[model samples]
Target: MSTAAPLPAHRLFSPARVGAIARNTLTELTRQKVFYLLLLFGLLLIGSSVLLVRFSFQDQFQMLKDISLGAMSIFGSLLAILATAAMLPRDIEERTLYTILAKPVPRVEYVLGKFLGIAGMLACALFLMGLLFLLILFVRERGVEAEMAASLSGDAAALAAQIETLRAQVFHPNLLAAGLTIFAKTCVLAALTLFVSTFATSQIFTVFIVTTAYFIGHFQATAREYWQAMGGAAWSKAFAGFVAILFPDLQIFNLVDEIAVGVAVPLALLGKTLVLGGFYVLIYLLAAQLVFAQKEL
Candidate 1:
């Protein structure tokens, strides 16, 4: 009896397979109760910022952007960690991982597919939150303009100039850059969590480890600066350097404060931050694949 011809090598690494996996993952994630709860909380927090009436218009606008951006960052990070930390362990627990791996799907493709799904979810969440934020800002801007126009009715030229200034402040182009950077930061966290989950025994352990890494990442730059400035022993400096390499410099993605206070984020700086985030994602995904390939299903 003649056996059927074996499939070509290129078919083993097909994008179609990866895309299918990604769509499946995304559907699974969206069905979770935690996803809806977190998204609702984030939207509420952003909307509540508009109720602060004690501050002047300028201060209110600043606070509005600050609070909204901060909420987006926090919620996005939490979602990334929680969602990704559970994926691998959950799949393995349900024996779904075994079935997937039994196919010709490569380990690398599986990892890439999972991360892409999480990334897509994050993008959608950010878009919704950003839309609400922009809406609130627009409403507030119109209200302030009307109030000022009524008070300065005698001076038509001055009213037009003031309205123009308010529009400029409310609609700065850098705000978009700030939103993009926040998304990038969340993607990095998702990738890191995926790497940790590859070897983690349980979902709780993965969450704990990734949460610690998140805190450490925020303080990484500070620790590196202090160690280098103190002129420590070789081992001390070497240890600091090791940490610097292992944990991402999350501060580099912190443009919320600057953007909050109306400081313009340069296009070049935004590009650099995005590039750094992409680098971390690539490195962690590669590392996860290496570990996952040898893992016993």
Candidate 2:
């Protein structure tokens, strides 16, 4: 009996394989004690913001939101960088990468799997932090309501109006949007770190390069504007353009300040920021695949 022909190379791509790799990556990352420690520290930092009750109610809420969101963003970014920067190198050092690639898995799928794992972990961490933030806001609002009621006991009408206003401010829907923006920013950072890790000689080198890129990305917009408005030389302008294309303009993802200050984030603006973040993620993942495909085992 004649055997059937093997499938084509393009048909070899399998979501099941990608999913398996992603699950394994996620398990490995979750088992690291450093991740738990970092997460606990972040939660404690957020909870500590409740101590800023000396300010007026509005100011107190503002500070609370500001501090909580800032903690999330900073911690989330650090986790993204640390988790992604170490993944590839650790796998290689342990020979897991060789065994995995020795299978039928394509390099592209492998890269995508690794990124998905990181993204999943980030999503879980953000969700936990966000839930705590919302809970804190709810509790603080209740405490403030009690204070307002006690102080304005003689004026029930004014008390109701003030409580309603406080409720609106404390639980603004924009908070959800802000949380999403922070998550998107972290995802971009994770993808960028992964891209750097592909060719980096070691985890330290990958982390260093990604950290530099993070700073450059945050300042790239301002630097570009300064260069263009200064009417600099051709080379300066060329350098600015090159930097702009090379690093993502991370400022666009900074809706935390606006949300903290109670500036309404339009749905359109949130959509644009998320899309831009996703674009950067896709670009970096593609670059990583290209570089990784040529990398020898």
Off by over 4 Å in 1: 1-10, 37-47
TM-score of structure candidate 2: 0.91
Candidate 1 per-residue lDDT, tens place, 1-297, comes to 999998667676889998989998888888875467445755565556547777899888888888888888988899999999999988998888889988988988899999999998999888878887888888888999999989999999999999999999889988999899999999999999999999998899999999999989999888888988999899999998898887888888888889977898888888988999999999999999999999988
TM-score of 1: 0.92
How would you encode candidate 2's per-residue C-alpha lDDT over 219-293 as one tens digit per residue? 999999999999999999999999998888888898899888889998888898899899999999999999999
* lDDT value, candidate 1, whole model: 0.88
- Where does candidate 1 clash, by residue pair? none
Off by over 4 Å in 2: 1-11, 37-51
lDDT of each: 0.88, 0.88
